[model samples]
Target: MSKLFRAVIMGPPGSGKGTISERIAQSFGLKHLSSGDFVRENIAAKTEAGVQAKTYIKKGLLVPDLVMTRLLLPRLEEMTKYSWLLDGFPRTLAQAEALNSACDLDVAINLNIPLETLKERLRHRWIHPPSGRVYNMCFNPPRIQGIDDITGEPLIQQEDDRPEALVARLRHYKDVAKPVIDFYKAKGILYTFSDTETDQIWPNISTLLSTKIPTIQSDARCASTH
Candidate 1:
C-alpha cells in the first residue's frame, strides 16, 4: 500500500489561498478541507462543539484551543483512508503541536504575499453572501456594478475585508503563524513560495507535489489507489 499524503496550506487573508487550494486539490486528487467551512457546517448543524463555538464567535473571541483541537481532530481521524489537503487550521503553536501529535504531514505550503498586495486585493473584494461567490472588483467585476451576475442581488464586502478590520486580521495571522511555520521548517517539510500572483507560484507547487506523491488514481475515476 502507498503512504497517505497529508499536507497543509497556510497564507494570510487575501493571499488567494482558496484559489490555489482548489487547484492543488484538483491537480493532486486530494480532498480539500477548510477549517472555516468545517466550523461553519458544524455551527449550522448545531453540533455540540459547534454550539459551543458559536458562543465564542458571537462574542468576537477566538475559539479556545481545546475546543478547536476537539473539533478538528475527529474530522481528521475520519479522513485516514484518503490523502487530503488542509487549509486554515492550526493557527498557533499550541494548535500545531496538537495536530503534530496526531499525524505527520508531508508538506506545509506557506504563501508569502506582500502586505500591500493583500491590502489592495482585499479592499476591492466583494462577495455574494448567499452563494459565497467572491469577486475582486479590480480584476473580476460582476456583470453589473455592485450586483450579483446570476441572481441580480446585491454583493456585499465582508466585514473583515473592510480596511479597518483587515489590518488587524493580517497582523494577527502573522503573529500566530510564525511559530507554526518555524515548527514545520524544523521538520524540513515547510515550503515557502513568494510571489505577487498565485499563477506565478503554482508551477513550483505542482512540481513539488509531482515528486512528493506517488503515482495513483490522480485523474482516474476509480477510487482504488496504488
Candidate 2:
C-alpha cells in the first residue's frame, strides 16, 4: 500500500493558519479538509447531520462535539487512500483524542503569533459580503475606504471582528485550545512556528512538510523522469 500522510493544524485567529494550510496541502499533495466547509456543505445538503447542526446554528449555539465527530470521521476514513491535512476542528482535547482513535496523525503544526498582532490584524478587517472578499486597513486596504475594490460595494465588519468580541473569542479559544496543544505535544508530533507574517510561515511549513511527506520532497525526482 502507498503511504498516507495525515496532519492537523492549530492557531489562534489571524495567525495565517488557513493560508499556510492551503500552501502545505498543495505542495504535499494532501487533501485539505476544513470543518467549516464540511458544516456548510452538510447544511446545504440538508442531510440528517445537517439538520442537527442547523438547529444549533440557527440558535447561535455551537454544534455538539459528537455531531461534528460523526461528520468528520467518515470523511477522514474515506481519505485514508490519500494524504490529508485537517484544519479547524478538534478544538478541545476530547476531540483530538477522538480523532486519534479514528486515524493516527503524523504531524500537527501550530502557528504561534503574539496576541497583540492578532488583535491588530483582526481589528482592521472588513469584508465585502456579496463576494466574501476580505480587506484589511493595515495591509491590503480597498481602493476607496469603506468600499470594495472590485464592485465598489460598501464593506461591513463582522461581529466577531469587532474589538470587544474579538478579544472574548480569543480568550475562549485560548482556554479551549491549550489542552488540545498539550495532547499533541505529548504525542511528540506537534511542530510550532512563531511567525507574525504569512510569508514567514509558508517557508517553514513547506520545509516541514518536505521533511515529513516524501512525495513533496520527491517532486523534483519525479519531474526529472519526464
Candidate 3:
C-alpha cells in the first residue's frame, strides 16, 4: 500500500485556505476534511461530542479543546485507508497539542498573506444571506453589483468582514496561530506560502505536493492484481 499522507492547512480569514485546500484535495486525490463541516455534521446528528459541543455553542462559548479533539480525532482515525487534508481545526496551541497526541502530521501548510492584502480581499466580499452564496467584488462579482445572481436580492457585507472588525480578527488569528506554527515548524513539517494572490501561491504548493505525495495509482493497481 502507498504511504498515507496527512496534512493540515492554516490561514487567517481571506488568506485563501479554502480555495487552496480545494485545489490540493482535487489535485492529490486526498479527502478534504473540514473541521467546521465535521462539527456541523456531528451537531446535526447529535452525537455525544456534538451534544456537548451544542451546549457551549448555544451559550456562544468556544467549545473546549477536549470536546474538539474528541469530535475530530475519531473521524480522522476512520480515514486510515486514505490520504487526507484537514482544514479549520486547531485554532489554538492547546488544540494543536491535542492533535499532536492523536496523530503525526506530515505537513502543515500555512498561508501568510499580508494584512493589507487580506483587508482588501475581505473588504470587497459580500454574501447572499438566504442562500449563503458569497461573491467577491474584486473577482467573482455577481451579475449585477450588490445583487444576488440567482435571486436578485440585495447582498450584505457581514459585520465581521468590515475593515475594523477584520483587523481585530486577523490580529487575533496571528496571536492564536503563532504557537501552532512554531510547533509545526519545530517538527519540520510546516510549509508557509506568502503571496498577494492565491493564483500566485498555488503553483508552488502543487510542486511541493508532487514531490511529497507517493504514487497511489500504481499501488492500487498492484493491490488489485493481488
Best by TM-score: 1
Q: By TM-score, how accurate is candidate 2?
A: 0.81
Question: Model 2, range 56-154, lDDT digits (tens) per residue?
Answer: 877645678889888878888788778888888887777888898998888999989988888888888887765556678877799999999999889
RMSD, one per candidate, in order:
3.9, 4.6, 3.9
Backbone collision tally, model 2: 0
Candidate 3 lowest-lDDT run of ten: 212-221
The residue pairs in collision within model 2 are: none
The TM-scores of all predictions, comma-separated, are: 0.86, 0.81, 0.80
- Give the per-residue lDDT digits (tens) of candidate 1, residues 12-128: 988887778889999988998888777777788899889998899777566888888889999999999999998888788999999999998989999999988899999999987
Model 1 lDDT-worst window of ten: 217-226
Tens digit of per-residue lDDT, candidate 3, span 1-226 = 5667889999998888767888899998999888877777788889999899989867645688889999999998899888889988888899999888878888899999999998998899898765556688986899999999999899998777788888888878889899999999999999999999989999999998887775544565578788
Task: Please state the error at residue 129 of candidate 3 in Å.
Answer: 7.9
lDDT of each: 0.86, 0.81, 0.86
